[model samples]
Target: MQIPWEERYAFMTKTHIETYELVEECLKINYFGMKYLTEALLPLLESSDSGRVVNISSNAGRLRFLNNEGLVKELDDINNLTLEKLDDLVKSYLKSFKEGALEENGWKLPGGFGTYKASKIFVNAYTRIAAKMYPNLYINCVQPGHTQTEGSSCTGSQTVEEAAKSPVMLALDDSGQTGFFYDHTEITAYY
Candidate 1:
């Protein structure tokens, strides 16, 4: 999955209005790109006996990063969530973002990168929904720790190789565990 950190950095210090387009671009690359790619590959994936789709997510994507309790509850209710509702929730986030009311609406993050955080949150939610919808597929998302990469300005604590272990583990495992989040190699709560 593409992280779109160049766009993220450009808008880091700007107001939501000033960065609206960049934020939208990030969402298109980070969230929509993953969603569409998975959809397009579903047929082929279903043909395999052990189809797997491992989404690369982030620690910032945790539901606790979102101050909006209602939104958190909505996303966590995977059994009740639908694709349309999840899309609508993302639309609501963008609307609030455009209006410069993210903080007022409880969607703001502490050190900015709110768009990235929201995008990954949507990704995690989408992974859960897809896993439920397609029981035959082993779909999951993983937070490959903070690795040194261009997106992070090379300030992350872990090396690229170190950060890759968790995702690689998920991709190769045949545990039949779906619709869950992993922090490195361990299963964790979405919040």
Candidate 2:
């Protein structure tokens, strides 16, 4: 006999994976999804006379300098520090960003939760570097602040709408500024 429709739906939505598996899955999906989406947007932007590609990053991206302790040191290998490695990563990310694909070449944190923070960090760096490399493109990341969203576990002090204000502002900005980060609709220092 066939299983009930409700049972099948429940099975599909179940979040019973072990912590490790969950993290791996999150990283794989998040990184690859962003890369693919960005890649698709590049061409459209290139052909357009004016356009902007805004990434939804987080305040966690700014934690790098202030909280160096949590920063991933895996990419700090001596070999990775070479100009060649840096150049290649920058070039690859820029090509995708300029073209509209976002391939994350950085390491995925062992736990998927922090990976979001790391992703934001990568996005922030890529934004700054890409802006300089492709002056014609408006590439930037906007921190929505601590908003109460599903991913935020509803623990944040701000509402989802409040958190979204910053990203919305960045998306609508026509000031010609690129590679900038905004916090709650205002320009904020990131990194």
Q: Relative to the true structure, how large is the alpha-carbon lDDT of every model?
A: 0.87, 0.57
TM-scores of all candidate predictions against the true structure: 0.89, 0.62
Predicted candidate 1 versus true structure: per-residue lDDT over 1-191, tens digit per residue: 54565564556446343378888888888888999999999999999998999999999899998887888899999889999998888887788889988888777876677788899999999999999999999999999987789887664678999999999999998999998899999999999
Off by over 4 Å in 1: 1-18
Residue 43, candidate 1: alpha-carbon lDDT: 96
**What value does the lDDT take at residue 183 in candidate 2?**
71
Show pairs that collide, candidate 2: 35-102, 38-100, 38-101, 39-100, 39-101, 42-99, 42-100
